[model samples]
Target: MADGVPMVATLAAKTMEVPGVHTLSLALDTHSPFDFDYGQFNMLYLFGAGEVAISIMGWHQGLLQHTIRAVGRVTRPLVALEVGQQLGLRGPFGRGWPLAQLRGRDLVFITAGLGCAPVVAAIHHAVANRDQYGRIVILQGVKHHADLLWQTQYRRWQALGECQVLLAASEEHRHRHHWRLGLVTELLALAEFDADHCAVMMCGPEIMMLAALKQLARLKVADEAVYMSLERNFQCGRGLCGHCQLGPYFVCKDGPVFHYPQVKPWLGREGV
Candidate 1:
């Protein structure tokens, strides 16, 4: 199949993660295998409703998984889809995390809100191949404790004894013994990783990632050692549409994932 053409896929399963958020498992109609790297996204089409760019969460039993927040025209309907319903899928697009290059080094994952979807698969890969890496530190932040998706997965990773998982709720007045009541960046102080020898993967709102870059710099983490997954108006999965451009690059083509140094100039800019 061509990259631009949408392929038929059936909704095999749906798991509600939180209010307005769902994990959809789609089984492609083709018999051939479908593979995608962590951090890549796919354009899911709903026939008349249009399409939206969603990050690939991973795969299970040959089913493609995407965690979507029902906040838009296409996404709202996509999440509401019932099992056995069919949709169109185009691509396992964009660049992905450099997990191969960072082998033997510590991994520090920083994410906020629903942006964690793009990095979740990478974390799972690291955990499954634990001996190949140094330390695994996961930090996530949400507006409320209940807003934290995959709460059970985070707890399971924490129980691994080697992985460090820290969560922060910025708007919560009440405290849970397992959660810190502050910004996710605050949890960085308590996270254990070698800043100089670790690779950092970050996703979320532009403001949040920018703030994290500053914190990482203070800890002597080189800009080259960090990578980020960026979001933009990806109307088309290909760069020809120009909807997802950032300076000379297109988020849908050049990257949804890029090394920190590659996008430093436009990170927090008002307009690109």
Candidate 2:
């Protein structure tokens, strides 16, 4: 658990979809149990290939799950590894979503593009403790219907009467009945929830999140009640690198998850 020490994690199982997007279910050594709150991420190293930080998709039993999109050097090679291959893992690092504060409040999750990955763990947490909260709403947006991930998982969550899943794709699709066509924020306008008693958690590109924040403000959701996952160029997950700095805070150390008010000053600030 030292700053640079990487623990060996064996690949237990995998679910492959497209070439670059897949889920790797990993098993860490039992003696060195890896436990992390939902929304936290781990630094994954593929031996000599290199390492990259990815959010934990979900966790169950003794396995830790990550949904990886092979976009960069470290990740492109990672998705090709076979099931029994071993890789180095160095975390559970960074701050996570505040699930405790969401108890008894209507919960809304707004995810766009790959932003859905980080919120998957939080969705599982909400589903497992359904009775503890009011209504649960999830709005997902992608460029095309083909970009949707975890459709079956979202269906399971929707089976529960307290939860609802709404998806919006920017482009037209044959499956029109299932999802609306527009920005995800358009669907947000139709959602009926208690604005005063709801907590909103959003993840997406900076532009999408900034636009969503504006819509949330129109709904009267307090800045403190809204949370977001901010991604930056994080080299060292421990915050020593200064690569992921955002104004006065370090994105890797102080957050990947932060309440809106805590980060308002730096959101879209020039050259922070």
Candidate 3:
């Protein structure tokens, strides 16, 4: 398929990660494999409901996977799709994490809510090739314990020799042994990573990312060392539509993942 053209994809499998969220495994109609980078997104189009920009969860058994929360017009029907149903897919768009540049550096991953989906593949890649990186620090925040998706996966990462995983639940009343009750940013203090030689990748509500950025700066991490994956109302998948614009760059084309300094001027600013 040509760039920007939607290709037919069959629903291969669907797993419910949480109550309203699901991971959809889609098999493209094309014979060639569908390749995408960590932090890239694809436009999933339903026949009548329209398309929505969903982050590529990862590739599994040659199928493209996407974790979607059914909170919008396209996503609600997308989660309801049965196996064998078909949907339109338009790309593995936008820039991804600069893993090449990050090699040999300690990696710090910070995410809140469902934002982890975009960075999950990168984490997996780093873990799979652990020798290429230094220590791995993973920090996540959720409203409650039950809201934490991929709990088992986090545990597996935690068990790794050089990996540190910290989870926080902001609204939980009862204490969980493995989780702390506070904002995700609070866990930053306990994360084990070399601030001077670590690459920080963060995604979440803008407020949370902003907070994390401030904390990272206080810890002496350079703005150049931090990267962020931003979410926006992406209408066109390409930069033609201005819905996903940030400052002078388009989130869909220039980046869904960007160096902190690239977007610093417009981040958290109102009416951008």
**Could you give the C-alpha RMSD of every candidate to the true structure, in order shown?**
1.1, 1.4, 1.0
Instruction: Give per-model TM-scores.
Output: 0.98, 0.96, 0.98
Per-residue alpha-carbon lDDT of model 1 for 41-122, expressed as tens digits? 9999999899999999999899999999999789999998999999999998999999999999999999999989999999
lDDT score of model 3? 0.92
Kindly report which residue pairs in candidate 3 clash with one another: none
For lDDT, candidate 1 versus 2, the one ahead is 1
**lDDT of candidate 2?**
0.87
**Candidate 3 residue lDDT tens string, 1-272:** 67678999999999999999999999998889878889999999999999999999899888999999999889999999999999999998999999988999999999999999999999999999999999999999999889989989998998899899899999992365558999999999888889989999998999999999889989999999999999999999889979988889999999999999999999988998
Please, what are the lDDT tens digits per residue for candidate 2 over residues 41-148? 899998777889999987767888999998878998888889999999988899999999789999999999889889988988888898888899999998888788
* Model 2: pairs clashing at backbone N, Cα or C within 3 Å: none
User: Backbone collision count in every prediction?
Assistant: 0, 0, 0
Rank the models by lDDT, top first: 3, 1, 2
Could you tell me the lDDT of residue 188 within candidate 1? Answer: 84
What is the RMSD, in Å, between candidate 1 and the native fold over all Cα? 1.1
TM-score of 2: 0.96
